[model samples]
Target: MKFVNSLLGLSLLLAASSQAHALSRNAGQTNQSAQQESPDSPRPILLNYTLLKTIDLATLSQNLASFGIKARNGVSIYKVSYATESLDDTSLNASGIIIIPDTKAAVFPWVSIQHGTIIAKAEAPSVAPFEGLAEASQGFVAVAADYIGYGDSAALPHPYIIAKGYQKPLVDLLRAARELANQKDFDLGPLFLKGYSEGGYATLALQKALETDYSTEFSIVASAPSAGPYNVELTGVLNVEKPVVNPVNLPFVVLAYNYWLADGQLALNDIFLPAVATVEDALSGAYNSDQVFAILPSTASGLFQSAFVADFTSDQPTLPTSRDLRALLRTQTLLDGWIPKAPTRFYHCIDDNEIPVAVTEQAVATFKAAGAPSISSVLIPSPTTGQPYLHGNCPAIFSPLQWFGEILSGKAAQ
Candidate 1:
């Protein structure tokens, strides 16, 4: 996890260019003045390329303000529309909000963002605490996909982990950002991907797909995936007894099973029992986070002998039981499949009760073994004293200042 001093080279380039352009322009002006024989006759001196290219910071700030973001101390914050190609047969007419810096028009860089589960558009404004947008405004073009059914679109059963469906939204969003950059006033630069919680899983999926499918169009500068369950089955086992576990995660397993099973990979009947089926039906309509958590266990318990114990048994033939499931899920599928084509920064709080820190730590190990360009894992302090009470403080844990400085300075590993 070493960050190279590449920003030094960039700084030198900017300084040298400015000095050379200034000297060249001054010399040309002096020659033009001398050529004017008459005091009344004046010749126009040609300006240097650097002067022509110079950006008026004040003007830029004014333009950025129109987009509901403020620029201060050389950083511009703004939200703009970014078009994305739809994967579900609908041609065109799809877009999302991309928060980026006004200065990125000069040095374009890419940053892909993924949101967590059950949270949609209105929820997003609260989720990351505006850090994602700030990241973009600081110097990166940060793109966040509303995941097909969240933002301005229909809220049908969100296909949680159906790989093709999930990845398409993200990839299309990235494509949209690139397309926007090609416009007269945009600068699309090198790309990076970041996500938290369920988004971590989506980010990994996009990274894998990009390396395998879209390498030519996009290059991954770095990726930060935090607190995602790479292994679906393992997640189920880990949450069996945890009171915080809810139906929000249930859809993911169902979706995964539906996807794989539809591909003839596994039979649903063989993997799940009648009780699990009833539980799934009851939990499907649960909307907000509170309802999902409050009703899931009771509904599931009514269907099965015990909501936690009955669903996972040692005798299950095809699908692994709770014990074996934990081992299987603990394995990092996302890290196992994708070769890190760029640097990666993985962060997870040691006190994360929802997604176990052990899972994230394992992922870090997996990426390291794969010879990832840069894999940095940060362990933030626990907010609680005991019993692991603190929740929903990821933004504070992974400070925006540190994240932005690392990426903007090109000190990010991978």
Candidate 2:
């Protein structure tokens, strides 16, 4: 525990700062008991699981290509509710989808998918219930957490980049998923985690947390976090000053971070110019992903004040507020200086225009240097020419392919 704390000192600092700021912002909005149940709260436990829907292999295969169904498999989607602490350490109810195989197979490892950023609550794994079915068709008990602010917990603000905030619900849902599988006579095995984009960040974040804090309670045989803004400082923070092909990323990151760290009280004026700052509500979950992007300007520089962009681009931020924002973004990073206890594989495309390939390449190098036992990185090549594609184009589409390929190769479960 001490070692985990030592490695995550900066992350813990961010959580602490969030709590302190939250107390000041939300004192009247929440109860004292709600804020008290946090890091010191009881260890997470499975509350219950409610079956939502079921799907067969024929139906699953119709949607996904390159997924081979070897057995007469069926999937049961369950709305898994569990107890977990909120970003500010308050006790809150959360939910996820537990997609378990209905096959009579003896046992198999768990494959959990952390989905990308979503606005509408229904798009979450629990409501959509079809997100991880392709993986479940392979006889793995697939689980996908709705994170904090989706599904049953939609009223609370989503802690977009908070790693620990999502990790707790994932851990608890796995327990509930396994229990539900047991009730249905499906055996279980080792665990594997995979996700792309924001989900990728979460997959890696949970892997690190499970390896350290929950080492005794859970384990992932392998993990693949592809093209996430894992290097939050560079990809998420500093790069906001540069001209970005996608303008929405900067405001989305800033808005979400302020919502969590500042108790939804942080002024948009501090981070954005009048154009972007004035439309803060639209940036929230009220609008869909595409709608939010359309609302913001097309260029990153257009989103912020000209002087702030000048300061950021010159690598000399004079504004005191930008430094604090930068620090908050830094806390969102994963796998840079941490050591892993399990064999891990990183997947990224060389031409990934969203998150830089350099981030993934450099992290793999640093993890090896930090003495991770077994670590490897794979490139998800283009579908036709077998070369890397742009960040969002290729890697976003290849997450499940990489996950299923690993399963076929017996990388995580043998």
Candidate 3:
């Protein structure tokens, strides 16, 4: 069987936009705490922000024109560093990018974009131009987070697919964005969330966190979680066991879980074949996805030990490592509780090779069964190929930003 390189052209396929309005640097505008604070209360999440750079209208337009996107407004990109708790309640400084429109407004709607799986640190929003640029140019205060493994937290292993762990950076980034807006005198209107691939999972996770814990502090207008593995216990864990296109992700997730959840108890030799077990060099921020892909087996399961494979495939795993993995994957599953209250849409290509469409279909069914208020799924087919839309190719065809724009303009059902 031939292995498909599903990670091809990912950087170009996932290109994004961002920027904020130019306001006077007022002394009072800096981040500050309330007059009175409970002794036990934590400090503010938004520590401080630095204006990284600004892109004028012409520059933004010229850059976007290559992708057939128009830039209506210039953008200012700011690198936001904030404090957030890690998996073990350790205080960590994480970073992300916030792109605000150049034009002044009393208020702007916030669109937080959770990026998909990124290998290199350079792919992080703070370092490179990815998805939120077009959004900022469209007049939305766009933000994208550099997950724990990237940006300020680059030294640490990313908590890949860990629902609770990944949501912190995203949640804190939104808090930072809101605080930044507040300091500028203007305010943010409705809140919107959008993400694809791993981001799609993060989107649902973030939404669940906000609706469950931060309801008073924030309200979601809508969410578009595209091509995410919400059913981690069933679909997510099983997908990698097969002949997957992007095999490198298997090690990525395993290494992350080992560090964050398993206390690094699972050794490289136990999880992977000796030939490919040494992945630290490739997974480090220095190497790109293509480089990582080159080192791993074409199929994820090919990298695993036969004993591990047998245990994973069995109905009841005898191996302690396999059992530990199942337990960890179960914790990340999102199909069970907390039906989304706000309008929600799950997008996917019916024939996605990386993350199967069944993942989204099953999630929608579960949400409906749980009496979700507003839930729908958009299954898009490849316009060019007329066949399967590989995971890397789906974003270019379906438009989350356009769907979000429709909702903001009151042109789409909310």
The reply for model 2, stretches above 4 Å from the true place, is 1-44, 66-72, 263-267, 274-278, 381-388, 395-414
Quantify all predictions' global Cα lDDT against the true fold.
0.52, 0.68, 0.77
Candidate 1 lowest-lDDT run of ten: 44-53
Please identify model 3 stretches exceeding 4 Å from their true place.
Answer: 1-42, 275-277, 384-388, 396-398
What are the TM-scores, per candidate, against the unseen true structure? 0.65, 0.81, 0.87
Stronger candidate by lDDT (2 vs 3)? 3
Q: Per-residue lDDT of 376-410 in model 3, one digit per residue for the tens?
A: 98988766645446787675323777878898788
**The best candidate in terms of TM-score:** 3
- Ordering by lDDT: 3, 2, 1
Superposed by TM-score, candidate 2 places the C-alpha of residue 12 at a distance from the truth, in angstroms, of 38
RMSD (Cα, Å) for all candidates, in order, is 15.3, 11.1, 5.0
Which candidate achieves the best lDDT against the true structure?
3
Q: Mind giving the per-residue lDDT tens digits that candidate 2 earns over 1-414?
A: 232223234223323443454456455542212112358776435566555555567755553433233434777666667777787778887888777777777787678888776765645666555557657777777888988888779887777777877787787777767766666666778788888778888888889888878888886777777777777877754366447646556666677787777666555676576554456666556776557677766666667776666655556566766766667777777855579777777788876767777788878888888898888888766667644477545534345445556665777441
Task: Give Cα distance to truth, residue 51, candidate 3, Å.
Answer: 1.7
